[model samples]
Target chain A: MTVPTGQCCAPIAREPLAEDTAAELAVMLKAVADPVRLRLLSMIGSHAGGEACVCDLTDAFDLTAPTISHHLKVLRTAGLIDGERRGTWVYYRIIPEAVNKLGALFAPLTEPSPGPVPQPVAGRSELGLLPA
Target chain B: MTVPTGQCCAPIAREPLAEDTAAELAVMLKAVADPVRLRLLSMIGSHAGGEACVCDLTDAFDLTAPTISHHLKVLRTAGLIDGERRGTWVYYRIIPEAVNKLGALFAPLTEPSPGPVPQPVAGRSELGLLPA
Candidate 1:
């Protein structure tokens, strides 16, 4: 798998997002804009192997299996996670690029190494250093 | 202003999110789940001096001023932004702690300074460096 650099590391706050890009990203964001899906994505992304069996996930919630599947399906459809069938179980794991895109879109930028520190927001000039 | 640390820097992927936390974050996510709101946020965040006037934001969209105001209200209500009225227009700016929480929810962990690099996900062990 090819790793996308630069494009997936820049924060969305660095500039105004274009219309098409915002629309595309909105779909991705909408997919995680739910409590169940957010927890599923978090669980799958942080599981011991960086992946989780559907069986492991079902035990964590009071909701029915179909409901969990539905949420997982939404996450898969959003490109945030992928599932693979392995014999008796389907294992789910995060799609790093997709997750990275979410990170890139909002991650506070790392401190700039070469240039002067970013200017504080107009009215917030009282802050001596803008947290990157 | 009091600064919130630790709580906002830990990524959601660090562990399974608690249900209440998931529900709370989902509300925040819903606010930016739209194409227009995302763009509005980006524009305000990256704008000169880190804030934008309602007039500036209104001109960027083809929708009526009230529509733009509605979207801004969602972001503000979600605690992602704060606005102030100075005579003619209400100037809006990102709430850094809020934005940082969004960033923290997904930002790839920064390079580890003391501990060993995180183990590559179970199947993706082929990757030598997990890019932060």
Candidate 2:
């Protein structure tokens, strides 16, 4: 799949995010906002083969089967997880792009090559270093 | 500032996320889940010197001062942004630890020496590669 890089998706924390970029990021973030979904993602991310079957997922949570299905649907809709039906069971896996994109949103940018150093600007005067 | 590292904050997607790690990440994600807050973060992230003044922020959006303050409070409480009053204006900047932690959460994990290669497991052959 194709992923577009935006200011928020940039590797460094110095840059500001664009309006559209924040909105896009928010959409993905919203998907993980729920407690059930967060637990679901944790289970899926920790699942063998980096994926899990719906049958396996249902047993882990105390929620109803339909509730689990609904949460899965939200995750699938948000692009955080992907699902496929095979025989009697449906399997779900974490979408790397979605996860990576979320992860990349927090990457610390480097100046040249050394790596991003997290410099906490206490107050003012450091604004000059940010991008224009 | 001090930052916590875990399987999720490991800079690669291979390792499974701990339940606590997912919860922590979810807390931060929820902070950015709002439309107004997303805009605020974008403005803060994009601001010169990596911060924005409250006065400047108030004029940019159509929301009331109280509403803006509420959003800022949410961001502050979530650790996405930090603010301090300086006489007349309150300046808010993106917390580097918070942003970097999020970014690190998505960082591409390097295997051995080269780098992480996104391996798309079609079925179940790749289950062995995951952590126990």
Candidate 3:
């Protein structure tokens, strides 16, 4: 399979992302934006040996097999996970680089504020940074 | 405004997130899943003084003011950004804690993998970690 590119992009907080780059990121983020998909990703990432089979994942959800399969497919299409069949079962694992790219995207926003905190600008309120 | 809760949840890679926790995360992620919203976020995050007024943001896009306003509203609703009116303009800035929560969600996935690589299990393919 072809490896995904764009791993080297700067964090969003460091600079404004180009439009095309933002589009690509939005696609990936959209894929993992569902509760089921996020849980599936978590399960796959934290599973023993860093992988889990489709059968194992289905039991954890109240949804049907096809629904779970659909979520996994979305993750794979987004390049966030991969699946390979072995006999009658398919095992999935997190794509570390993709996950890392996401982490890097937000790293600047999350990193502790550096240098002195700038006073709120002359015409802006100081209410923007409060925890959501 | 009431501060949003759930800032202290563990990263998704550290363990399987609770159902409700995953739901909340999904809501926030879904809000950021659009291309325009992502670019707007990047612009707000990287702007000088780490904040930008609505008037400034609208110029960066090839979109109408209303369209840009809609996108910014989405970001604000997601808790990723905050906007407050000062005079005739509303300035927006990243919500450090919310962005940090997102970064932390994937931190474990991105952190250098720990320990020796495990042998591929008997029934699974070893192709899952390839970048992408």
Best by TM-score: 3
Model 3 RMSD, rounded to 1 decimal: 11.1
Could you tell which candidate, 2 or 3, scores higher by TM-score?
3
Q: After superposition, how far is residue B24 of candidate 3 from its true place, in Å?
A: 0.5
Tens-digit lDDT track of model 2 for B14-87? 35454556667778778878777877886787678777899888887788999999999988888778898889
Over 4 Å off, model 1: A1-9, A110-132, B1-9, B110-132
CAPRI-wise, candidate 1 is acceptable
Task: For model 3, report DockQ.
Answer: 0.29
Which residues of candidate 2, in runs, are more than 4 Å off? A1-14, A112-132, B1-15, B109-132
RMSD in angstroms, all models? 9.9, 9.8, 11.1
lDDT of each: 0.74, 0.65, 0.74
* Interface DockQ per candidate: 0.32, 0.27, 0.29
Per-candidate fnat, comma-separated: 0.66, 0.41, 0.60
Q: What is the TM-score of chain A alone in each candidate?
A: 0.75, 0.73, 0.76
Error of 3 at B118 (Å): 7.6
What is candidate 2's DockQ? 0.27
lDDT of 2 by residue, A1-132 (tens): 112332234543444555566677788889877666876776665554555777766765578999999999999999888888877778787766577666665655545334343322212111111123
Model 2: lDDT of residue B53:
94
RMSD after Cα superposition, model 2: 9.8
State which candidate has the highest DockQ: 1
DockQ of 1: 0.32
How much is the lDDT of residue A21 in candidate 1?
75
